[model samples]
Target: MAVIKAEAYGHGMLRVAESLAPRVDALAVSCLDEAAALREAGHHQPILALQGFKDERDLRAASQLDVAVTVHEDSQLRLLAATRLHRPVRVWLKLDTGMGRLGFAPSRAAELVAALTSDPNVTAVPGLMTHLACADAPERPENAAQLARFEAATRHLPGERSLANSAAILALPDAHADWVRPGIMLYGGSPLADQSAAGLGLRPVMTLSTRLIAIHALAPGEAVGYGATWRSERPTRVGVAAIGYADGYPRHAPNGTPVLVRGQRVPLIGRVSMDMITLDLTDLETVQVGDVVTLWGEGLPVDEVAAAARTISYDLLCRVHDRVQVVTG
Candidate 1:
C-alpha cells in the first residue's frame, strides 16, 4: 500500500486518495487529523499515520479510529507501551537507512521490534522499512548503497519489509519489497529524471491555473515588474497572471521562464511579485484579460517550470499558495 502524505504533496489529499482508492491497497498520512478527515469523508481504505502519536490521548484517538502508526523511535514505543487502549494498534516499524530525518537505527530495529511485538496492545508488527535518498538519480550509486544497507540490516528480521517509494518503484527494480509506498507518482509527478508521469500514462490529478488580470504593450527599454529587472529590448505584449510567490509560485523564477497561455508558451518577464507575474506574450496573437494561464501543468512540464524556479518539482507541488482555490476535475 502506498500512502499519499501531506495532502498528496499539496494536491488535495481527500480527492487524490479517493481517486487512488481503487488502485492502491491503502493510504498513509502524517497525522491523526488527516486520518480522521479521511475517515469522516467515508474513506474505508486503511490509513497509516507516519508521524505516530505524540501523547496518550493521540494514541487513544488513533486506536479508536483504527489508524496504523509508524513506530519511528523508542520514545514513541515507550508511550505506546504505557498506554492502555480499547483496541490494539497496527504498527509499521520505520528504519533509518540513511535518511537522517526519522526512524530507528538499523542496528536497533530488532530490539525495537521485540519490544513492540511483545506488547499486547500492539496488533500487527510488519517488520522493517527505510526511505531512499536518491532513487530518482538512477546513475547515482547511493540508491544501491542504501538498498544494500537496508537489506543487510533486515535480512534476519522475520517479517515483511518495505523499501520502495515512488522513485524506487520506477527506477530501482530490486528495491521493491513487501509493499511499495509511492506518494508523488500517484499524483502524476515523475520520480525519474528523463520521464514524467504523463509519459508513463499516469493522469495528472491537479491542474494549477490562473487568469490574466491585465495586459500591456511595452516598447523598447520599458521595464516590467518588481526590481525593474526585465527591460523590453523590443515591442513586447506583456500579460499579468493573478499568481505570485505568495500563492506558491516560485519567486526565484528568472526572466524567460515559460508559462502556457492558451497553449502558447510565453516567456516570463521581470521578478515574480507577491500576487502576480508578468509574461511576455509578444508572439501570442489573441491573449486577453481573463485568459487562462497554466503555470505548470498539461501544456507546460512541471520539471521545466521547477528548473526555471531554481528548485525541484516536489517543493513546487508542496508549496502551492494556500489562497488558490483547488478545483477537483
Candidate 2:
C-alpha cells in the first residue's frame, strides 16, 4: 500500500492517489474523509484508513465506502460488534509490538483475531500490522524486538500481514510481508537519518520555488528582519525571496540555511518572516530582483533544509501551507 496520508505529505493527496492508483495495490490514508475523497474522485482501488473510524457513523461510512480500517483499540472493537452494516467492513488488527502508541497487546492477537474473524460485521481474517519505532535507525535493537513480537503474534494467523514502513522497507527486508506501507520514500524523502534521498535513488516529487522580490545592500553595522537577530558582519547584499513560513517554509530555520539562487547556493539571513526570507547574496553579485529562488527541492534537498531547521523532512512537507500554489509538471 502507498501511504498518501497528510495530503501525500503535502504533495497533494488526490493527485498523488490518482497517480499511484494504477501502480499500487492499495492506497492508505489517515481518515475516512480521505478515503471518501478518493472514492468520490473515481478511484476504485482499495483504501485503508490507518487511524480507523472515530465513531459508529464513521464506521458505517467506511463500510458503505468500502474503505478498510485498522482496529487497534477495544473501543473500535466494541463499535464493530454493536454496529450492523450493509456489508462487512475490512479491518487490519494493529499490534502494539513496541510502538506504545496505538494497537492492541500482541499477546491478545489470537483472541482479537478470533473475535474479528468471527464477528459478522467484520470481514473474515483481518489483516495484521504493526508500526516500527526505530526502523529509521537500523542499528537500534527495538526494530528487531518489534519484528520479533509481531512475528510471534501473527506467524500463525490466517490474514495478510504488513510490517514495513518506508524505513523498514529499505532496511528490514525480513519485515517486508504481504503489504509494505511506503510513506516518506514515496514522496522522495529519505526515511533513514544517515541516508540522503539521492543515495536511496528517490527523486523528489515536489519542488518549492519562488521569486526574489527585492534586494537590499546592508552596511556592516546594520541588522535586518524581525528581532534584529542577525547583523551584517560585512557589506552584504541581502536578497529577499517571496517565500516564508506562510508558504510552509520553516520559521525556525536559522540564518545560514541553504537556498538556491540563480543556480548558486546562498545563505539565508535574518529571521524567516511570514511572507519572506532574506538570503545572503553577497557572493552572487549578478543576482537581481525576480530571480528564481528554490526553498527546497531540485537543486536543494528538503532533508538538508529540515536538518538545519532541526526538524524531519516529513514535518516540513506536511506543514506547507495551502496558500502556496502547486504547479505539477
Q: Best lDDT goes to which candidate?
A: 2
Candidate 2 C-alpha lDDT tens digits along 1-329: 99999999999999998789889999999999988999999998899999999999899999999999999999998999898898999999999999999999999999999999999999788999999999999999999999899889887889999999999999899889999999999988999989999999999999999999999899998999999999998998988899889889999999899999988899998999999999999998698899999988897999999999999999999999999998988
lDDT of 1 at 259: 92
Flag regions of model 1 displaced more than 4 Å.
none
RMSD of each: 1.7, 0.7
lDDT, model 1, position 306: 83
lDDT (Cα, tens digit) per residue for candidate 1, span 1-329 = 76777777878787777788888888889898899998899988788888888788879988999998888877888888788899998888888888888888888867877888889889856657888887888778888788888887778777787889888888788988878888777767788877867786666666788999999899999999878999999998889999998998999999988899988888888999999999998898787999899998776777778878787788888888668897755
Candidate lDDT scores, in order, read 0.84, 0.93
Candidate 1 lDDT score relative to the true structure: 0.84
Q: Which ten residues in a row have the lowest lDDT in candidate 2?
A: 149-158
